[model samples]
Target chain A: MEIVRIIVLALAGLLGGVFGGMGMGGGTILIPLLTIFGGVPQHAAQAVNLVSFVPMAAGAIILHIRNKLIRFKGALYIIIPAALSSAGASLLAGLTEADVLKRAFGGFMILLALYSFWSEFFSQKARKAKLPAHDAPTV
Target chain B: MNGIAKKIILLACGLVIGFINGFFGGGGGLITVPVLERVAGLKTKSAHATAILIILPITVASAVIYIIAGKFDFGYGLPAGLGVIAGGVLGAAALSKLSNKLIRVAFAAIMLAAGIKLLFF
Candidate 1:
């Protein structure tokens, strides 16, 4: 039983890391897997996801850097503000209710999924038709 | 907009991305990539790559907070993290071979499924 649990967690992490290294946020999938399938509490799941993300990102970043894919100037612009906000928000998360956080996360994921679909399917075509010579910016 | 103003706006957007990361543990890239592409004038792949760098510091900061707050569990987290590292290497290698459009479709499908499960069941 103990080994089973460890295996499950490791599998979940593997899935998360795969997507995460692809530049998609793995926690979007990992948190849900941990809470719903792994029987971890929501807050603990989030904590674990965050902690695990460090190694995953580190691994991916090394490859990206070697490939010269990272935009250092842009990254520097975002890092300081983002790091500060992340710290502040984490403290807030620690205080929030688990159920509420879960629901909110669910809603956010649904919206993101819908937006991704739209952008990929309809929006991409529309943008290409409108600007044949240039790739329009996406958001 | 001017260069400095554009950068400032990007920084502000980072704050929002960071907040989301801290609150949710991950998902900052969803916002980061698009914003970088649209606001920072990066190519899609570059935006994706840069998002990883942007999230690294935020994740570290959030993880530290979780650790300090006694929310992080090392025993479970360590093994999972090891798995993640291995997976990350594989994914990074595969990225060069995969189509971006295909990746986007897969990402949407996974997020949709995960979202529905979380919301309904």
Candidate 2:
């Protein structure tokens, strides 16, 4: 049973990484996989995702930095506000009920899926009229 | 555009990104990439890479809070993290060859299905 659980979690991580490593938001699916299938609590699953992403992203971020793929210019503008607000939200999340967070996440996921569908099918065509999309990969 | 205007836009976008990421524990990259491209005027590659750059600090901050809040689960987090790191290599290597649209459409379906399941079930 322990081995099976490990396999399941590992598989979940692999799936999340395959998508997330590609920058498609692996945690979106990961949290759900944990809660719905793994019998993991919502808060724990979210924390797992957060903790897991650290090491997963570490090597990639370093590679990106070494390749000069990252632009440091004006980055603090985004980082500062993002860090502060995320910290605040993190506190709020701890205070919120698990079910409420799950519901909100469900709603957010649906919205993101709809937006992704539109972007995949139609946004490029519309965007074509504006500027050439030099699409690039990041994770 | 102008420097101050761009800074303001980045700052506003950052606030949104951080709140979403911290509250949910993920998805910052999705929003960050587009913001980097459209608002920051980064090329796509740069946007994606920089999205990671931006997401890392926010994620770290959230993780710290979550851990301190007593949410750490080594049993759940370890294997998963290892798997993600392994899969990251495959995904990165496959990125150049894969048809992104195909992958995305398929993933989108899964996302919708998962969303429904989470919502009602």
DockQ of each model vs. true complex:
0.61, 0.63
Tens digits of per-residue lDDT, candidate 2, B1-121, equal 6777877888999999999999998888888988888877778788888888888889999999999999878988888788878777777888889998898888889888988887877
* Residues B1-121, model 1: lDDT tens digits: 6777888898899889999999987789789988877777777778777888888888899988988988888667876777777777777678789997898788888778877877776
Please report, in order, the local distance difference test score of every candidate based on alpha carbons. Answer: 0.80, 0.85
**Interface RMSD, every prediction, one decimal place:** 3.0, 3.2
Name the candidate that leads on DockQ.
Answer: 2
Mark the regions of model 1 whose C-alpha exceeds 4 Å error after superposition: A129-139
CA lDDT of A6 in candidate 1? Answer: 86
Backbone clashes in model 1, listed as residue pairs: none
Rate residue A38 of model 1 by lDDT. Answer: 73
Error of model 1, residue A85, in angstroms: 1.4
TM-score of chain B of each: 0.87, 0.94
> Which of the numbered candidates is closest to the native, going by highest lDDT?
2
lDDT, model 2, position B21: 95
